[model samples]
Target: MAYNCIVLVKQVPDTANISGKTMKDDGTVNRAALPAIFNPEDLNALEMALRVREQHGGQVTVLTMGPPRAAEVLREALYRGADRVILLSDRKFAGSDTLATSYALKCAVERTGDYDLVFCGRQAIDGDTAQVGPQVAEKLGLPQITYAESIQALQGSEIVVQRAFPLGKETVKCTVPCLLTVVSSANRPRPPSARRMIAYKLAATSLECPALLKQWPEFETAEALDRYLAERDQKIPVWTAADIGADEEKLGLPGSPTKVLKIDYVVLETSESRQVPATPEGASGLVRELIQDHIV
Candidate 1:
């Protein structure tokens, strides 16, 4: 019984390298100011999907929504063993909150035909809301298992998984055709294969034609380069809002209800310090002072 799996991935701004210029005055991410990298937990999700393919015999298709440059993540997925990669990109998808983002993703998932499983990261570093995966599941009307640590069994239509919790781990059993939001602790993502990398290095989306032309100046036009890539099955599919039949009103800024009224960066600095003695009485005194100051 082979399953058809789809993994949703993202290329997010490297939050570890964030600076003052990371956020714009409008409270939106200044993506141009930071380097973009594959989301960490999404890699875990991808690894899980790859494992499913290896074990149960299935195809792993990767999908992502972002600017045209987001196709880089899809290429990385190919190098890591994904069978198919698609990019959901358009200007209309800009400024989407989790709600709108999930809506668009739900549409894209539907476009991918039948699938027995969907995998997603627990959250994206840039937003950290941890809402998109569950939201997508809800929209797709599928059972969702979040914070999955590992898969224990997949027999017939039932799947058993271990989930991580603050207190401990819990085992959950759900039927097939469900969605899973994977945690980083699930499994270590495998490094890209050198052979796969060499095979897919030339794979690119139509949006990347301009940059490709710069490297291969022999191409008389971007169309010619696109033709060459297409001929070799290297052109990644770029889907627009209309391509996926997404509702315009339910996408982008118009669909987003959350508004950021302010953006502030908080920095903690010790302006003054007091040294308390290690003795019990000294500790008691410090506790009393903290209580009086309402610090605890």
Candidate 2:
């Protein structure tokens, strides 16, 4: 049976290179000062979902919650083989913590119904909470498999997967229509295909359509979009929040419950030491000293 899959991805600031100045005095991220990139583990999740589509005949839809600029990742997903991409962006979605974020995502997922499975990264590198997937599953009232290392088998409406545990690994089976949080080890995400990238380079999201129309009044109707898409070899479908019937209150910042309280910078001090080489007998004596010091 063909299984429809939805993958959730995120664009996050590169936190590894973060500095004190990266955070504002209000404890919010200085987004202007940071470069955005797709979350690493989320890419793995998308790869796993894409593999499912490859093995079983189905469409893979990618979803993300971010600003309008985040549409860049959706196009990137299309270039990487996603059948459809939806951008859940609104000014109200700003300053969302994990709880609010999941709520909005759950709404988006419901709007894109008819999927048998949902995949998400274990955690966002910037947030590092690892709570959105499970929270989304809870909101949707679906079975969840967290920290999935690999999908062993998918047959009919049942799926068998290997999950990673602290002490050891365990294989678990679950019914279809489940949510899964995947680790970076799940699979290697494929690089963007050159042809697809070139085709979709100027693709526009629904939010961007108006601006495009304002700039180029020549292409105004569905036919115009179709002709443009054909000539450009791109997929450009505009979907509004009204089309998705998303609740306005449950979508933006007002629907979210978590808030960033503070940002702190930490510094560490270390001492440096040098080791001296020793002759054979001196080495033996050093070994004896190490054994006595429990350092052997």
Candidate 3:
């Protein structure tokens, strides 16, 4: 039996390079100040889905909700063996908290037809809430497994997975047509195929060239480019809230209850320093002091 899978991915600002300029006064990320890359754990999620497809004879579809330029990640997905890709983009999606974002994703997933599995990273690096996947599953009324470290087995409609925890790990068995929030430790993702990269280099979402042609004169007409891309079966489909039949009030900011009012950058500094002996007695004394001070 062949399984159908969807891998949810995100293109996130590289927080590792975060600086004072990373945030704006409006409590939003200054995306232009940071390089964007595929969310690390989402790659693991995709790799897991691909492995399932390889083992069971299935197709893998990768989907991401982001700006027009996010098509870069979609092309990257195609180069790495995804059977197809979708770009969920619109201005209304901007500034969405997890609730609204997941609602939109739920709508998109519903349109994708029935699937054996849906894979998402444990969290996006930007938000790190780890809520979107579960929220999407809730909206779809499907069972979900989060913090999935690895897949253990798959037989018929049931699948086993190793779930990671701080103490240790636990194994879980869930039926198919379920969702999983994948962790980076799940598997080492495969690199892009050079051949696929070369062949799919021209693949792009419909709005990509139009947005580019305005800024960079190197781009051709969106229509011509899309037509040319059609020949190679490489034109990516873009979806909007309306296209997916999402409720207007539940599509973006209005549907989101969580709002960031402000952002404060925290920095740690030593107010004072004290030397402690490396001996056991000295460590015991320090622990005693910490306990007395309630700083332990």
Candidate 4:
């Protein structure tokens, strides 16, 4: 029997290139200032799902919840090996904390029909709380294995995974229909297929049709373009909160209980840096300085 898998992925702001405008006064990230890229760890999760499909003969569906621009990641997934990609984009999902985000994801997962495995990255860089995946598991009432480093084996109705802990490693066996929060150590994700990339380059979600039409200009209407893309199975799905049967009260900021009381932006200066000659004494001095500064 084929084991169907669903991979939850995200497109996050490239925090490494953060600028002065990266944070707004409201304490939320000003994503407009940063280029978006596929979340690194989520790519590991996707690779794990694809590997499972390759081994067990099943389909991999990728799902993400973000704005219309988030379809870029969905298209990237198609260029990889995902059989289907769905975008959960609705205005109501804005400003959602981990609790609210997991709630929406739980509903989306339920809507995707039956699946033998669910995969998610351990955490998103923008919010390194590492809460969403396990929260999703709790919301779905599914057993979860987090910090998963690698899949060990799959027995009848069960799966074994090697996971990492603070000081050691562990191998856990979980039943099917379970969620696995993968870490970056799981596997090296495959690059996009050149053939699939060419085939799916024009894939677009309905909300993206207007921009596509502007770029292509061959299509007279967005609806016509949508139909054309859909015919070729290149149209990424866009689902709203109502589409997934999510309660409005539990959908977004309203459902998010975590409040950001304050956000302080710190700017490092050259004076903060200390240098010493490259020697054993220098290393000892550095360790002493770290200890004195309470940074070690």
RMSD of each: 4.8, 5.8, 5.0, 4.5
lDDT of each: 0.94, 0.83, 0.88, 0.91
Question: Which scores higher on lDDT, 1 or 2?
Answer: 1
- Show model 3 residue runs off by greater than 4 Å: 19-31, 211-220, 265-296
What TM-score fits each model?
0.87, 0.77, 0.84, 0.87
TM-score of candidate 3 to 2 decimals: 0.84
Evaluate residue 234 in candidate 1 and report its C-alpha lDDT on the 0 to 100 scale.
93
Name the best candidate (by lDDT).
1
Scored against the true structure, residue 266 in model 3 reaches a CA lDDT of: 52
lDDT of 3 by residue, 225-255 (tens): 6686687787899998888888878867888
Worst 10 residues of 2 by lDDT: 233-242
10 residues in a row with least lDDT, candidate 3: 211-220
Candidate 4 lDDT tens digits, 183-228? 9988999999999999998899999999888898989999999999
Model 1 lDDT, full chain set: 0.94
**Sequence-dependent TM-score of model 2:** 0.77
- Candidates 2 and 4 compared by lDDT, better number: 4
For TM-score, candidate 3 versus 4, the one ahead is 4
Candidate 1 weakest ten by summed lDDT: 262-271
Candidate 4: TM-score?
Answer: 0.87
* Tens-digit lDDT string for candidate 1 (1-296): 89899999999889988766787766666878888999999999999999999999989999999998899999999999999999999999999999999999999999999899999999999889999999999999999999998999997899999999778998999999999999999999999999999999899999999888999999989999999999999989999999999999999999888877887655446789888999999999999998999999
